[model samples]
Target: MRGKSAKYILKVDDDMWLNFDVLLRILKTGAIRFSLGGKCNYGQYPFRDPKNKYYVSYSDYPMSIYPPFCSGTAYVADSDVIKQILTISPNIPFFRLEDIYIALCLRKLRYEITNIPGFHSTKIYPLACLYKSPMVITSHGVSASELRNIYQASCDKDGSMYVPKNPQQLPERMILEQRWPKGKLARKSFKYEQQLLKHNLF
Candidate 1:
């Protein structure tokens, strides 16, 4: 990463709606330069049900409430933060929950996470709400059609799409039918994020 000249590293999941147009402008405007930015989830409890995919064994995480962590859907950390996390990772035991693990590392490093607007990490906002948001970044659990529609609306300068109606009235895609990649494939594709992190490219 040092040789590559990348400044910020953005980690995102496959099932998300990203407004790159708004993100590009935000990055160029240099709003979240120092802090880790994302839709942060606070005091989340670790799932304990054995049948649940996110289940964490009692031995793995005995705490009732976890430390504040950004939703796994999306988050950004600067190169310095990344390097620091790598340096400290040897001490913290391996954690299966990706976002929580990052938060643990950040906590060890005394790094703060800045909750940026429009991350919508847990749910998708209405199209109008998303389109109008200046800091709009990512929406979790979006279908392919939903992703395409959101991106198209972002480019619609003349307001052909993304009408500003009440959220309930809008044609909102509330469910995602997409199937996520299993264990190994998921780990591999995590490194497959966009190169826009390098040199703040649009």
Candidate 2:
């Protein structure tokens, strides 16, 4: 990371949905430079059950509460912070939770973790109305087709595909199917939207 020319590093999971335009806009504002992501498991206790995937033995981590850490789904760290973490990692005992481990390293260096509300840790519906907001940064549980639909809806200029955020602003159970285009797989994507509308799921 120290050898890289980029001043900041953005680490993202393959499953997460990212809006590069919005992220760039945020960076341009200079509000977030060091480290920023959704903070989760702030004071969570280490898993004790051996069957659990996150189980941590006393030898690995004797501490009960984990330090506040950002969700590993997606996060941005300054280049210097990345280099510092690598330099000190060998001394600090390894932990299964990489995010928590990184937080511990930051704590040792006396760096603050910046939490962004835009970074959701859980799955979120890629609704067109939500994406229109410049504050919306990342969403989880996004498929290829859903990503296409959301991006298209965001770029719509005719106002035909505009959906209101409030249910009261539109008709009851009225779905603007035209806004959500069925790209490569027509039926599969359309049916998924129909099911979502039927269940009022978002």
Model 1 spans > 4 angstroms off: 1-3, 123-135, 152-155, 158-161, 165-202
Once model 2 is optimally superposed onto the true structure by TM-score, how far is the C-alpha of residue 157 displaced, in angstroms?
Answer: 9.5
TM-score versus the correct structure, for each prediction: 0.69, 0.70
How many clashes in each candidate? Answer: 0, 0
Show pairs that collide, candidate 2: none
Please write out the lDDT profile of model 2 over residues 64-93, one tens digit for every residue. 888888888888877778888899999887
For candidate 1, the per-residue lDDT at 114 reads 77
Give stretches of model 2 more than 4 Å off.
Answer: 1-3, 154-202
lDDT of each: 0.65, 0.65
What is the Cα-based lDDT of residue 128 in candidate 1? 31
Which candidate leads in TM-score?
Answer: 2
